[model samples]
Target: MRACHALLAATLAVAVLLVPVGAATTAGAPAVQQTPTPQVDDGAPPDRPVEVLTLADDDANRSATRETTLDVGPAVGAATDAAGHELRTIRALARVRGADDPDAALSREFDRIGARAAGLGRQQRSALQAFADGEADARTTLLVLARVDRAARALENRRERVVTTARGEGATVPSERSVALARELGVYTGPVRSQVAAALSGAEPPARVYVSTTPRGVTLAALTESGYVRETYRGDLRRVDDASLTRSAARDAVAAAYPSLWRVRSAVDVDPARVSTVRMTYDGGELAATVGSRNRRVFRDAHRQSLGVAGTDRQAVNTRDGFRLVVNRSYAGGPMRIQLRTVDGDPVAADLTIGPEGGESSPVGTTGPDGERWLLTPDERFTLVAIRGNTVVFITMDPLAAPRTERP
Candidate 1:
């Protein structure tokens, strides 16, 4: 019986030793294994192992041993249970220490996230503040500019209205408006410009085309205070307002006739001064004097007999103080005497010729055989000229091609 009891005891111990520690029973309930958590600490947590602590004595008799058998926990469980109060104390300590291990780390992560969020918020706030400041500055600048603009507009509105009148736009002198401006600016002029301006002021706003002529050329003035209408020119020979028109006519007429001619320097009209004296005389009591411009020419003819053949004894004559005389005769060659005379009857004889199919002669005096004397040259082509009633003659020619006749 003792031997059987011992064997049975040994078997029971072996069975107990085979039980798992993780499934140790407490109050008849299985121990539950929870998922492990990593505990952050200075040292690693202690690991518990499943253990077998067995006393299998085959020689021991149950009756002699006074067997009071208790079904303890598994081997590692029993050892842990034997130290249960201490294990409880250790677990409580571990629980308390676990806070120290991971608490700082959790705090650090949270603090990191909070700091990042705070920095982002500060950046956003700064951007918004800068935008608001820029808007304020722009509004202030716009207000100042608006005030300046209003002031400028007010000044423009306060500016005075100006009314002025002027007569001659084409005149050399200043217009009425111009005069006012000049006076305002403190300027002065001589008698001519002042007189002209004053005279113009009395007239209508648009000036009339007044004509005046002198020995040199004609003048045509175009005047206006009004903006509209083309200017007019006063002219008999040609339009004088345009210097080009005058020049064209002059170049066409005078340049071909006189080699000594040159273009006038100024386009403005001017008059030529009179020559001192011009006299034509002959051996007899006959004289013709012309005092004026150089364009005057004189022609003379002296014939002893009236008729010899159809045309005979004709001479072409020229006077020194500018005169051209021609003798037209039917005869091809003829003997003739020609002379230029002073008012006191002194003769300057000239070259004589005759080939009269009626050619042209220059502007001057001419006498026909009928004793008819023409002092002034005809403006058109001439057929005949002759000395008339024995009154001497003086011709004054002006540069504007005007003829002034006087009897001597």
Candidate 2:
């Protein structure tokens, strides 16, 4: 009896030692404890709401403008206008057709333009840098910019002609990368061009230039010594109404292209055939500006316009941490402007890091008091990580992604 009792005591001690910590033994069976799974919140909405807003009839004609000041001269103005005209011509040529080995032809043209534009871009940057360093005057810098713009525009025009001709001959369409490169070559100088034109015509260019768009068209305006000098292009307004060439048809077309917008606002007059002289309010001016920019390339293939290369591209997203992030890229591989703000629209200063998705990240810079930073974008898709205190937000940045037509 003593021997048996000793053996039982030894077995019990071994059993207790074998059991895992926090595990329970019931009826001589060990019960394993399970760890609860962790939950992760990515901050994206379960169903992202489409972002589009349309204005009421009373506000449809209104314009929203952003103003800036820059020195201008006659020579610079003429050169700027000439560059703008060349870019416009390139856009037109993209609608035309071409013949024989168009792809090969396009590739050669692209190489030529690429080489020339790169040299000009470098020159422009050097001149601008000199001006920034106070080594060059504003007039001199503007002249250099104008010259570069003119040369770049001509190169782009030549490339577009090749693309158009090849496309007509049933050659493969140019890639988005090529189109983006071309667009970068002919940066939008609308505001500068207008001011320069005013100076060229022997008028004192306004100290403040306002760039705006309305249902009527894109307008560049300023309060000059003489009066308010305004230049408007009705092309976009007309294009918006060209879907079926009728008011109702145009409304339906706008609805189809921008369904989210159609759901909200009352239909406005879209009669392309008649002159609309009604003075409109600027209810959704930013939205109008976005749509106007898009309208310029409506006739082109949907793929090219997807990049939003025709104008400034803006996108906004809400962070999981109750912040709003806005990114603006005028063209692919161009300077990207990043803005961080609270949900209430107050700017937030935060450190920003960027890298390829699922890859190592590097710190770029922090936003300033204005909650904005500008950086050159890479040609590939990447991710932006914004950190403010314990709050961290991740946003995927696809430089080639289609831009949303919503106001940011």
Candidate 3:
């Protein structure tokens, strides 16, 4: 009995990836998770009519919510108006893709301009030496210096334009067609465009990218029903309007390719007056679901798993939203917290640790979800296990991570 309780407690302690079945079990005692919910004083006073509960529409959203935002559409360049700007990026990409790269066009351009300036500096000394040795022409030396200076300045200006237009550092947003361009950009509208423009004007492209970022069925249910919660998060995939796109073979290929790394969990509930929900949960902790007209699914990258899983029957699920899976035990290798890559591929992982890290920046209160100003260690953890039924990815996390989260 003690062993079973210990295992269940351990199951809750780990942040996620699936745990093996026959997990610690007591012969007769009920699992803590299976225990019935205790009644709360949430019932209204007698004589008051019982009201229906609905997800808040920007008002009473009291879920413990966390969010991450990023934009990872295509990279920002290909300036239309600037004739020469696009040429540079295309050329740079060409250089990146080059085979022999003998001339090294991009680097050569940078070097060529630098070399001219260096040659000019050396010219005066070389000219003096030649003059001393009575082996050079003064007029030729002077002309060489003049030509180098003129050429160097021209190269510098060209380089500056390349930096500015490609990265939007000094250049404007090319506002001439902002309105029309916006529609094409879609959800990656204002901020993404602005960020892209800003990025192009800088030195390097963004360091990362987001493959997906959407919440799912389970996450919504957990958040809306969880006690006194507040959070902001982004999921791995977006639940698009079209089912075809969601359940396409191409997507399945992507999932099976990287079964352990990428997956989906989906579920449907038909209780409480014909309510149906599909939650696609990933080890990445992205949650997304579909209720009615709205299609919800977390977006994430193509962690294509090339190898195939050898098994008699693997779970596969498809419904209104669409999803599939390849099974694998997530935490077999080691213990590491799961994090979803934002559109920019930044770490937008859910903070499951109840340590100082999660507390320091939490908006819940002055200290943290706990009364203590800080959590010295992780009181909880979760591990990724598997994505089931096309849309349900089962996970295990220590409910202790945010102990007293309700207080905040």
Local distance difference test scores for all models:
0.22, 0.43, 0.25
> Which numbered prediction scores highest in lDDT against the true structure?
2
TM-score top scorer: 2
lDDT score at residue 265, model 3, on the 0-100 scale: 34
Across residues 257-330, which tens digit of lDDT does each residue of candidate 2 receive?
54454455443433232221111112232122112222422111011111222224444334433566676532
List the lowest-lDDT window of 10 residues for candidate 2. 7-16
Q: Which tens-of-lDDT digit does each residue in 153-263 have in candidate 3?
A: 344555544434333322233332221122111211112222223333343343111111111201111011111111111222233332222233333333332233233
59-135 in candidate 1: lDDT tens per residue?
22111000011222222333343365344334433433344434333233233323433443343233323322343
Order of candidates by lDDT, top first?
2, 3, 1
For candidate 2, the TM-score is 0.32
Tell me the spans in candidate 3 whose CA falls farther than 4 Å from its real position. 1-24, 27-30, 33-178, 186-408
Candidate 2 whole-model C-alpha lDDT, 0 to 1? 0.43
- Once fitted onto the true fold, the runs of candidate 2 whose alpha carbons sit more than 4 angstroms away are 1-100, 186-188, 201-408
lDDT winner between candidates 2 and 3: 2
User: What does candidate 1 score on TM?
Assistant: 0.14
